[model samples]
Structure formats: structure tokens, C-alpha cells
Target chain A: MEELLAEVVNVLVVIVEACGAAVIIIGAVWAFARFAWVGFRQRTTAAFVPVRLTLGRFLALGLEFQLASDVLRTAVAPSWEELGQLAAVAAIRTALNYFLSKEIAEERRQVAAEQDHHEVTSTDHRGSGV
Target chain B: MSAVAEVTRLAALGTGLAAVVAGALALVVTRRPLPALAVLLDLLLAAGLLRLAGDPDWQGIVTAAAIVALRHLIGVGLRAGGRAWTGPRPPAASAQEKSAL
Candidate 1:
């Protein structure tokens, strides 16, 4: 039963890790495609902020999956050496996850502020018949 | 597991290359070097995290940690620089510029 549990957990780790990788790939591809399309369409006037924000959201989601897999790995790691490696890996990922989350929040706030400013200015212009 | 790691490493490389292209495109679109740098570093961070996935050795862990640290340092620098560089834009002038655009 112990052997069977370890095997199941090992499989679960691989699957979770794969999901994380898939999320990153999809996000990267989507972001690149949008960047290229918008760059060509609007040239210098384009707003790449939204694109970057989307990519950031996708990356954060992917990191969450990767961290989950790291936690799952501990379930099957029987050796001290393996556990040490897992711990180090998990620590790095956790740090990254925290930073990513913080940046995403900051960027989102900035984007919202910019939009608000834009709207207010446009409204003022309309009021003055500019 | 080695094969898995190799594949993931390769994927990470591809993601890094994509980041370079995206960063360059952002530079062209925004005409702002710092924002482009931020985009590049952000994507590279994603790539580094992806590389850290799967079974990695001490070397891999160290490299990922370095990438994360560099990302944090650069981010702080960019924020400071952005504030200093933009320092109090006149609202009327920016509105005129937007209108012109």
C-alpha cells in the first residue's frame, strides 16, 4: 500500500507539473501573438500594457500550479537528499510566486489609474467641446 | 525524469527567446526602454520558473534563485527610475499630447 501511494503521488506530481508547463506555453504564445498583432495594427500608439497584464496573470496562474506540484513532490520523497532538493526548489518558487503576485497587483492598479485619468480627460474635453 | 527535465529546459529556452522578441516589439511600440526592459525581465522570470519545474539539481536551483534575485533587483530599480524620470508631468501638456495623438 505504501508503494502504491508513492507511485500515485509521483504520477500526480508529473501531471501537475505538466499542467503548469502547459499554462506557461499557452500564455507565452498568446501574449506574443497579441503583441505582434497590436504592434503592427497601432504602431506607436498601441497600448501594450493590457497585453503585459494578461501575460502576467497567466504566469501567476502557472506559478501556482508549479508550486502545487512542488508540494505534492514532498509526499513521495523518501530520502533526505531528495527532500532537501525539493525544499530548496519550493523555497525559490514560493519567493517568485510572492513577487509575481505583488507585481500583478501593482500593475493592475496602475492600469486602472491610467484608464481613469484617460476617461476624466476625455470627459473634460467633451464638456469644453475640444 | 532526465528526459522530462531536458524537455522542460528546452521549453524554457524557447520561452526566453519569445520574451526577447516581445521585449523588442514593446520597445518599438512604446518608445520606452524601461518598460521594455520590464517586459523582457518578466517573461524571463516566467521562463526561469518553468525551468525550475521537474526534478532539478543544485545547479538548477541556484540558477533559478539567481534569476529571481536579478528580477527583484531590476524591478526595484525600474520603479525608482520611472518615478524619477516622469517626475510631475503637467496635466495640460499631457492632455494636449493625447489630443494630438
Candidate 2:
């Protein structure tokens, strides 16, 4: 039984190493695409990031629900540290997304307010000219 | 193939499929892709961490660090890209001015 355990362990080690290497390569490709593409980032943020944050704010309870599910899943059969890492990733992504969305909203509100101010001043100037 | 080997192969398949899908979707769906592109990176990182969890090694930790760095880079790109995309559209007169110049 010990021998069998060691064999599986060794295989898992190789598998993990393989996966890690692949992720590194994937990161590189992502970096490359972001740089190589023209104007790809512009369209994505307008449509998605805010949408993500708005959903995230509403999904707070759902997150707790997910945590409960994760705890149960891990408790039943301890899969690996990967699940923990994935959870970490999810948390970081969501938190960062929340902050970013807040910033974007702030900027939009400012711009809109300015536009309204500009319109009011322009109309006032026209009345004086007439 | 042994179960361990099969698992590894499956992980490989998953990573490849995710990269392709994410990249393609990013190209099709948005003008600003920095954030969505990060999803692809996350998927790859998840695969690595998942495998490492089973394997438990130093290399896995290193991989995680690299992935984080990439995520940061994407955040930076998104900031820059958002500014450019959202820059106020020049009034039509400016377009005519440029055409004259």
C-alpha cells in the first residue's frame, strides 16, 4: 500500500508541474495579446466590467452561499490546495472588480454633471446674445 | 493510461480549451479586452493550482506568483485602455479640422 501511495504521489507531482508550466505559458500569451491588439480593451470595459460589479454587489449573499458549498465540498473529500487557490482568485477578482467599478461610476457621474453645467451655461450665453 | 495520467491529460485539455475560448470570445465581444482577457489567465492559473493541490510542490507556488503578476499587469492595461476608449469624442468640427490639416 505504501508503494502504491508513493507511485500515485509521484504521478501527481508530475501532473502539477505540468499544469504550472502551462499556466505560465498562458499568462505570457495573454500579455502578448493585450499588447498586440488595437483597441480591444476599450470596448470590453464599457460593456462588461461595470456589469460585473453591479452583479457582484447584488451577489454578496450568493458569495456566502458559495463559501458554504466550498466548505462542504472540501470537507467531504479534501481534493487539493488548488481549490483554496481558486477561491483566493475568485475573492481577489471580485474585490478588485468592485473597486474598479466604483471608480468608473464616479468618473461617469462627474462627466455627466459637467455636461449638464456646460449646457446650462451655453443656454445662458445664448439668451444674453439674443 | 493510468488514472493519474488521464487526469493530467484532462487538465491539459481544459487549459487549452479555455485559452482558445477566452481569446476568441475576447476578440469578438469587446473593444477593451484587458479585463476579460484576465479571465483566460485565471482559468489557466486555476488549472495549475488544481493540479498542484494534488501534487503539492514548490513549483506550484512559483506558478501562483507568476499568475498573480500577470493579473496585475492586466489590471494596469485595463486602466490605460479604459482611459483611451472613454476619452471624449472630438466634436465633428475637429474631424473637419483634421481633414483640412
Candidate 3:
């Protein structure tokens, strides 16, 4: 009876593990799709197109890698190596977030500079008007 | 049932209630859903981790912590992510801003 109960528990664990792996895959894919859509939307603005696209691509890659690590964790991990990989994946996500925000800040700064220059030029032209 | 079990159940119930109240208050107080959801997610993460840590495997603990981090990230991310809150803000003139006065 004890052996049978142990087998049942193991089976249940495996099932849950599979479910967890599937969840990570779905979540990562969803995140990547959202990132791509956001990138496409930003492209319409024609501002910071290159920086934004690069950042979005990096974020999507990070999400995919993180998802892969998450799936591997549930599949074969009850080990230090797998846990370390998961940790690294988490770190990469954090780094990706950091760079994306940096990109946004740079974009904002560029916009502000352009606006200021426009204002200055317009003011100078108006002042020089005969 | 058993006293410990009863108390645990009650604590769980209380946490649930607090979570709901916080969520409602968040909308009224901040008028935003994402931050409120993040707060609720964090609370749930804490409650689950506290309850499940004893029997947890390695993968479970890391996954749980990562989930909590994501919730926290959502809060900061949305703050920096710039939601579609752009609109005609209050004009510079206080006289213009004063609608009731």
C-alpha cells in the first residue's frame, strides 16, 4: 500500500511539473507577442524606431530564454545546475527590463531636444521677421 | 475541526478579504487597476509561499519568488511603461483649473 501511494504521489508530481512547463511556454509566448505588437505600434511614430525595435527584440528574446529555462526547471530539475540556470534567466529578464527603460529614457530625451530646438528656431525666425 | 486548522482557514479567509478590500480601495484611492492587481498578486504570493514553503521543492520556491518579482516589476514597469493616461491635464492657470470654485 505504501509503495502504491508513493507511486501515485510521483505521478501527480510529474503531472504538475508538465502543467508548470506548459504554463511557462504560454506565458513567454504571450509576452513576446505583446512586445512585438508594441514595437509595431511604435514604428508608426517614426521616432526612436531603431532603438525601440532593438529593445523590443531584446526583451522578446529574454522572455523566450526565461520561458525555456522555466520549462527545463520543471522537466529535469531537482538539481543545483537547473536552479542556477533559472536564476540566470531571471537575471537576464531584469537586465532586459533595464535596457528597455534606458531606451525609453533616451527616446524621451531626444524628443525633448527636438522640441526645444524647434521652439528656439521658431522664436529666432519670428524675431528676425521684417 | 482542529483548532490549528480552523485558525489557518480563518487566516486564509481574512487574507482573502483583505485582498479584496485592498483591490477596491486601490481603484477608489488610485483609480488604476494594474497597480492594484500587482499589490494583490504580491499579497497572494506571500500568503502562498508562507503556507507552502515547508513541503516545497527547489523549482517551486524559485518559481514562486520569480512570480513575486514579476508582480513587483509590473508595478514599476507600468509606472515606467507609460500607460495611455495622456490627456489634457490641468491647464497652467489655477483660475482655469478651478471648476467648482
TM-score of chain B of each: 0.79, 0.53, 0.46
Cα lDDT for residue B39, candidate 1: 76
* Model 2 pairs in collision: A40-B31, A40-B32, A40-B33, A41-B32, A41-B33, A42-B32, A43-B31, A43-B32, A44-B32
Ranking by DockQ: 1, 2, 3
Off by over 4 Å in 3: A1-77, B1-101
Better of 1 and 3 by DockQ: 1
Q: Please write out the lDDT profile of model 2 over residues A28-84, one tens digit for every residue.
A: 344334423422454433343333333323223323333333333333333556566
Root-mean-square deviation (CA) per prediction: 5.1, 11.7, 16.3
Q: How many clashes show up per model? A: 0, 9, 0
lDDT of 3 by residue, A1-130 (tens): 8566656654554444334333333333343343344334542233323333443343344344434434444544457865675565446445544654664566567567768989999999999994
Q: What is the TM-score of each candidate against the true structure?
A: 0.88, 0.37, 0.30
Q: Residue B67 in model 1: shift from native, Å?
A: 0.9
Please write out the lDDT profile of model 1 over residues A27-80, one tens digit for every residue.
888887887888778765326778888888898888899889988888888899
Clashing pairs in 3: none
The models' CA-based lDDT, in order, is 0.84, 0.49, 0.46
Cα miss at A74, model 2 (Å)? 16
Residue-level lDDT of model 3, residues B1-101, one tens digit each, is 43333443344345445545544544444456664564355334333322221233456556655764675577567656553354335566556668657
Stretches > 4 Å off in candidate 2: A1-47, A50-130, B1-16, B31-39, B45-55, B88-101
Give the Cα error of residue B71 in candidate 1, in Å: 1.2
lDDT of 2 by residue, B1-101 (tens): 45544564466456556655655666566544565565455445344433333333445546645654575577567667777886777789689989999
